[model samples]
Target: MGLRSLQGRSGLVTGAGRGIGREIALGLAAEGMNLALLGRHSATLTETLHACVRHGVKCVALAADVAHPGQVKAAVDSVRRDLGGIDLLVNNAGQVDRAEVPLWEADQAQWWQVVETNLRGPFNLLHSVLPGMVERGSGRVVNLNSGFALRPDGRYTAYATSKAALLRLSDNLAETLRPHGVTILDISPGAVATEMTANMPMFADMVHWGSIPYLVATVVDAARGRLDPLHGRFLHLGRDDLEALLRDAELIRERDARTLRLRPYGDEDPLAAYS
Candidate 1:
């Protein structure tokens, strides 16, 4: 579908107050999609909402902590009441531990906080939105994932574990949701220049940065169902070639590539066999 096909579609984006979330919200708005922006801070969300409105599409801002079920429900309900049922959902709100310490050295509270925000946040939003999408029989979901999900990162245990689990969540849901005409994609935006990355000491002197435009374009394409054949797969904007991937969509589906799975010890491996 062309970008114009997105016009009049309704979407809800978490963490729409700033950074990549803000960019995604504006990009969707540019496609003429109505937006419901959810963020922890009203001030920043208002800024994004105003910018999106300039695109001549309907926009609303709601302050809600994505980790809180009550807040997410209320926020989603308001979006349905105002902009209509959400056709797209972006799980963009995430958090990292304040300190980049190993699991044993990490503060308990801070570690759990990161886990809850990154993992539970998406769970809450999905729980609140999936029923409506299933009832409608058509919807798209994009979960902002990371390389840490595929590779083991001991330094940021909580963040890495949360993201890894989220990728699995996307994969598991895809199998069930596909028959309902819903698509779920786990997209890794990579190491983009964002407030979250800047604050991490590990990336203090990082030179190379991922392209935000590429990431946003990938997201838009996924939202438009351009990559539906590869649904429930992990996509890395920095490393994976989108055009090439699209061309190889059939092979990807046949081989179940780009998904997190247990490496089979041999051809007889039960897990791999089942897959």
Candidate 2:
């Protein structure tokens, strides 16, 4: 896993219309990989596809809502037919609630919508896309995760809860994929400035924004096997040092750090092992 070429590989990227997803799509395309761009808006998807094709790689844009099971299934079918096969999947589509409010005051439908897009969207893609990967014996999945998944936030409960569950999904799925030569990982883009971020009251005082180019490069690294050491763990671009983490991979795994888990009171606690 020290080095591998992404040339000739094919991938599917959800929410490829704009922002981080579009950058990632272009990054992969530049590396000579074929791409299938998925999102709800066809016009934006077309724009991304145009940009991706300029990299001189095969590309297609398919419009569909990732949150809907049927739509995702159909889109995946098109990917299989158009791109030949999906070697890597980037689950980048997500939604946020209306405002930073308490759970009781949050709009019920909007809360659930956020959860549906962030959590169920990934579930639908995994379910529809994983079987083929398992059968082939090698694959990679990159779920665009968030820091909120690591802690609780009453102000953004829906986003926090869904991301937390998604992280758990990767934790367990990694074990299942290991024997099959597949890997799943979680990564947070680190408070990147976007329309979504500008609207959030939490980042009003922010000065620096995370680099989308760096995030795209990291995603490419994962596909090229440079980050195979971190297959199941969380990678927070803002907080983690890539070289340090890679060099200390064994120590990190030994301590089971950088993952979501319950902490016990002390080593003497009877439930310490489980925690």
Candidate 3:
């Protein structure tokens, strides 16, 4: 389980102010990794920072909105200056749509805002963080993906669409960064109970909500390069069998599974990558 020598590795996690981000940050710290925490809430970031500090790992908390490219650049610069360099990047900041309405009936501004946060936020972080990782020839990026990305849903069009786009981005980045020794992974944390989900009416009848410890550990493994064989893949903590995925990575790649891809009409299709 302890596949990494993380005593001096530095990482930055967005949305580290609360929820699963805070938990993952704390888990990383416990594994002896130094961290820079980014979020819009200064107070919550401080609270997380304080907790991580108790683990005796170097930690910094910065208040910044992930949706803004300018803020992301500035925050990443500070992370570089303070942490020496980033070995891991976790794009976890995201927002969900409030209403379960059809796209035609959705609030335009709110719809776009969810896209800005869920998709553009990750893009902003990757834009700012990739240069350094590429230059250094080592880094891992974990995007907080969702089940919505893999399925078509009538409700929360913005959330589903944005997550789907993020998954595609992760796949593209993984291929583009392979030669540079950087890896990008997409993982859904599953139905973890949180303030955000508790408010969503979609789960009103949900009998079971899962824990995030497994998700956090999987991320840690990804950060450690233990899961590099499955890079460019999408994993769901609630649904995926990690051991099987790791063991059958060759089969997974041979079939091009666990990735977002367009289905070809037939073997004669001209645009199909598989063809």
In order, what lDDT does every prediction score? 0.91, 0.90, 0.91
Regions more than 4 Å wrong, model 1: 1-5, 267-275
Better of 1 and 2 by lDDT: 1
Candidate number with the higher TM-score (1 or 2): 2
lDDT per residue (tens digit) for residues 1-275 in model 3: 23335789999999999999999998898888999999999999999999998888899999999999999999999999999889999999989988999999999999999999999999999999999999999999999999999899989899999999999888778778989999888999898987788878998888889778888888888888999998889989898889999999889888888988778998778878753
lDDT of 2 at 178: 86
lDDT of 2 by residue, 28-95 (tens): 88888889999999998999999888777889999999999999999999889988778999999998
What are the clashing pairs of model 1?
Answer: none
TM-score of each: 0.95, 0.96, 0.95
lDDT-superior candidate, 1 or 3: 1
Worst 10 residues of 3 by lDDT: 1-10
lDDT of 1 by residue, 104-211 (tens): 999999898888899999999999999999999999999999999989888889999999999988988988998999999999998999999999998999999999
TM-score, model 1 to reference = 0.95
Q: In candidate 2, how many Å is residue 28 off? A: 1.2
